[model samples]
Target chain A: MDSAILLVRVLDFVGTFVFALSGAALGVERRLDLFGVLVLAFVTAVVGGIVRDVLIGAIPPASVASWHNLALAVAAGLLVFWFARAVARLSQPVLVFDAVGLGVFAVAGTQKALDHGIDWPMAAVLGMLSGIGGGMVRDGLTAQVPTVLRSEIYAVAALAGGLVVVAGGALGLPPVPVALAGIGLCVFLRLMSLVRGWRLPVARPPEP
Target chain B: MDSAILLVRVLDFVGTFVFALSGAALGVERRLDLFGVLVLAFVTAVVGGIVRDVLIGAIPPASVASWHNLALAVAAGLLVFWFARAVARLSQPVLVFDAVGLGVFAVAGTQKALDHGIDWPMAAVLGMLSGIGGGMVRDGLTAQVPTVLRSEIYAVAALAGGLVVVAGGALGLPPVPVALAGIGLCVFLRLMSLVRGWRLPVARPPEP
Candidate 1:
């Protein structure tokens, strides 16, 4: 495999693991049983890509067709289940890992959309969708408002990364550099928002 | 259009209207602003079909591709927003409407899957998905556990309806009669569950 492809694959696995961990942690906090925790983790790790694949006409969804991704997600969930206390102490690290995953998925999704002959604008949209879709489903399953819909910077960062990929790809940039740039932009924006505690303004209550 | 196709379209619009009304009512209860109400209504009215269409590789999603569907959903939302107090008085009617919508979507989804040459088992699954997908998204956006996952018999009704469609199709039955039988089965099961308070067993909490 090409080095670029290899790097992407590695990042994908890393992202999936950390996302699953976060989901499992949430399940534990919610006092969900083992099955619910596993379900949440699997859905959180894979739903984004599945939604993207479906939107782009990838039949059966890659996550459903392949066992590798499902196994990794399930393994991560089981690990968290077993080491809940220890993993709880790594909250900061988990956040960082999640940011990395967000960046990687955003660029990867945009690239996939482009490969499928989608226009750049739609590719960018699909990238953001791919990046935020899992977290949305995770929060939904846990009965919480999705962070992307209400948070300060989640989807925006993903959108920024996707736009970068679209621009870079459109300009005939090298694949590795384009991917790296998008990832960097997304991670930087996410971390900055987290540290700054910035938030998107909520709509004021309508007058009765 | 064939008479069967026309009937399907009429039922589709009826389902969309009632589903949208329910979603809009929920938005009102949540005190969501006008935009949120419209969004909830639109999602509830169409998401199930969109999900089914995507799974079956029907590109562009029938819901997104049609202005008529969009208009009806929006109108339904607006009606609820403006007349919520009055609408609330008709709770009994709403339940009946919701059951009808559920039944029709279940059968329609299965038929569409078969038309796309999907196998019967998968078509049945997709049919259930189509019947329940919109409600899941609607509840999720409102920060609630999906009714299908936790409630009495929502998804069961859909699954039963889907199976009927699959069986009827496989037996070379006429489309109109098969579809009606599936719808009747779904509505009956759902209403019975509502009246009798049927519930799926919840998983036991894991040993701490």
Candidate 2:
């Protein structure tokens, strides 16, 4: 049991780092100052989780209770700001890290919501929201259309993973296997979308 | 009592319009496409109130239930986008509208939270949050530091107004007078800050 807890903690830290990196990368692309970068990192790393907890009546939220998330965000922010030139040279690192972050957050959020006694469908929706909310906010802050609303299939990836978790739980699958399967599906779908440039078609403007 | 309800509805509509205008102005400044402008307007006008409602267990929130707010946002968005140059020529119209919107939201949020049985301090906090939340989001999405954080007076103005409401409620004052006093204080403080360039001192960066 202790080992399982430890493993989850590790994955959570990795996910935090990835999301922070993606946010910091956007800040750097926009040439924001150090304060701006750190702010963005914090927002991306923990805002979704905060929103999830608040919705479920979890006061203060996990991000405020645990220092690890803040530490991870700050560290990632510093690293990205200091290595902006080198990091920018590696094209599309943000996309890769964002996918991984989404998968981890979706599974974790679903598990947490279930623990709070919310029904499966609502839990799935909240989980998907937790997975993509940060990135959506980050994109909006940077004056770009939210990637979720664009053709990226981002929210859909989270939705697919959450549904897997819901179904697995219904079938009485063990939590470990259920989480792994959900996360794996999410990561696969997100990556595939990025690689293939999958997008939803825009609604046509009304005729004059 | 019927008159009071009518007044509240009128104030709410006016607040919604002002908030929508602020958001549309931002979209125009950023040169967002029509869809982006509409999205920003929708988000800025309703996101804060929606968040406050959801936090207090008001499901779906007012923005989701009523189509009026959505129509107001869309109208403002289209107007701003189509008359971007003309709007820009009107010096500081956004700032004026934003300040009025903030005052209106602060009073309304406090009153609603009290109606829902929330205590004074928490209600005040929610009121301030409702007033500033949308602008924070709007600024963040535009790749700029949140004005609420930098313009310390903005949140403080809301806080002052909310505090008045709490105090008046505690003293068994009528709701109408309490609301008017609160709104007046918010407007006065915001305008003073704008005209005097008042700002909070930012913490200096630590020396390495």
Candidate 3:
């Protein structure tokens, strides 16, 4: 059943690029040094996949070992660094990129988990983690609570998408189409939250 | 050559307990809920070991698969929760615990990497990562710059300890004594740094 290796690879790179862009944008916006920006770009782009692979007993995670991913991340970082003023002006686009990245990462992560014979429930968990883990580490290096853990309607959407993919697989659906549907739903939910200003409720304002 | 399995196991538990205590203390000081405190304790206690395990191609990391570690973390959390005022009064102790945890984790991690047949340079790096990884994640969850990345002699101490272990191995020394020497050096350096107000240099404060 691990028939979706190519699909996972394609989606992984797509997610990497978009996530790198978002990470670079955030680092630039936060006024980090160029080195810091590049670090953010590289880490934000690949950490999710790395974490997923590590958990699934994949050694030397593909993203970590690939120079191509590094080149792409550096390219994204440089673009943001060189266009700081312009990038700064387009703050809203960062979230859009993040949404796209989340969708693809989730779908890819789920498919990879399935490829490795992970069951649906644990697979969905891994998939959702694959979607959000990078952004969490990105925010961490910036010294902030992860938006996913704070007020964003983020993790739920990722989990939902992962569940969709696994469910489709159970129904004997084609991998590519099922993956596409999962990505669509994840992106839709994330973007909708941004547009609608929807937020997960905080128990209370942190006790200051 | 892997003659120190017992040493590693002991060190791991020691590190886990102290790290969990420090994390629990931080969470209580930060006035987080019980759930948050426990999460912090659990994560801070085991994440370093988990990361080290994952990198070494070990499945379901010993720390992650161990209920004893969880019980210890929860116990630490509960202690802090029930005695918040007492814990809040002992801020300096938290740093001490963190330093101890770092030392033990570094030693344990170095030994494990060597046992896994990893080479020296990579083993040392992995060891340092193990020492610092948990504390970094703990600080991140609380929405702050990792103290290790900022003004601390943290990574250096861990790395140096790791080097000592590897050097001892290369010099044809026994594993257990070498590990203890490594741990001693790490703890000494960290403690001295605390006493002398030593810190890693920052180029300049981040521009506000």
Candidate 4:
């Protein structure tokens, strides 16, 4: 395989692992059964990419086309199930993993859209969707409002990183440097937002 | 507007109203707030058509293009809220309306795909997707496994109806008769499944 393909594979696996872990942690937190955990993990890891591919006229998409993504998700699900108690003991690791997954997935999605000849603005939008869509679906399935639609800067961070990639591409920057910079920007923005409790202001409640 | 366009508008409105009512009923069953109810109604009435359009490379989709759909959903949402108790009292009436909605939406989706020059098999698949996608999303949001995946021959009924439309088109049948027969088949199948507890067999549990 070419170096580009090799890089994509590595990033995809990382993104899949992080996404699966976050989903499994949420299922464990909710005390769902093993089957539920696996389902959540699979959905979180693959649904966004599947939707993205379908939109871009790619039949079957990466999730269905490659067994590796499914294997990674299933493996993560089993590991989480077997080590639920031990994993639960570490309080903050899950959140950290989820943030890392979000950054990786957002950058990967933007790159994929750009590869498909989608325009920069639309590619950025698609990237944000890819980062957040799975989490949104997972949260909805667990009876919680999606974090994306709430006050969180989650999608905003993805948008920022995606725009960076677009800008870098426009300036004729190398792909690796552009991707690394974009990913770093996303992680920094997301971590800072979480630490500072930064959020977009909502419409104020009507005065009494 | 042309006569054909006028007919599509009428069917679309009727389908939207029925779908909105069904979604509102589900919100009431879940005891959600008014905002939640409206959101459900809006999503259920439009999401499937939106997905169908997006898949066929129709940007923004009908949900965004036609403001009337949103208005209709909001109106139905308000009506349901105002008459929640009364609506709840009319138990099976809601199901009947839902069946009508399914039939109309399925036929409309298939016809729209055909209009876009998609092949028969793909159009049938898209039709089924348009019929069931919203319900799946709604069920996922409500934290229930989608009924289309678990119970009743919901998507299959849509597929069967779409096949009828496709066959009729291949046989050079007129649009009006083809539509009527297609919609009728869908309604019959859906109502029969609902009444008779018809469901596809689940994969047998692994041996102990």
Pick the lDDT winner: 3
Clashing pairs in 1: none
Chain A TM-scores, candidates in order: 0.88, 0.90, 0.92, 0.93
lDDT order of candidates, best first? 3, 2, 1, 4
Model 1 CA lDDT for position B94: 45
In candidate 2, the residue pairs with backbone N, CA or C atoms under 3 Å apart (3 or more residues apart, or in different chains) clash, namely A140-B141, A141-B140, A141-B141, A141-B143, A151-A199, A151-A200
Worst 10 residues of 4 chain A by lDDT: A199-208
Candidate 3 wrongly placed segments (more than 4 Å)? A1-3, A6-10, A13-47, A50-91, A117-126, A133-208, B1-3, B6-10, B13-47, B50-97, B118-126, B137-208
TM-score of each: 0.60, 0.57, 0.61, 0.59
Lowest summed lDDT window (length 10), candidate 4 chain B: B59-68
Off by over 4 Å in 4: A1-5, B1-50, B54-111, B114-208
Range of the 10 consecutive residues with the lowest summed lDDT in candidate 3 chain B: B60-69
Clashes of 4: 0
lDDT of 3 by residue, A13-92 (tens): 89999999889988987888999999999999999999888888787899777698999899988998998888778758
Candidate 2 lDDT, A108-157, residue by residue in tens = 77777776677676677678878888898888677786776554667778
Candidate 2 CA-lDDT value? 0.79
DockQ of predicted model 2: 0.06
Candidate 4 root-mean-square deviation in Å:
8.2
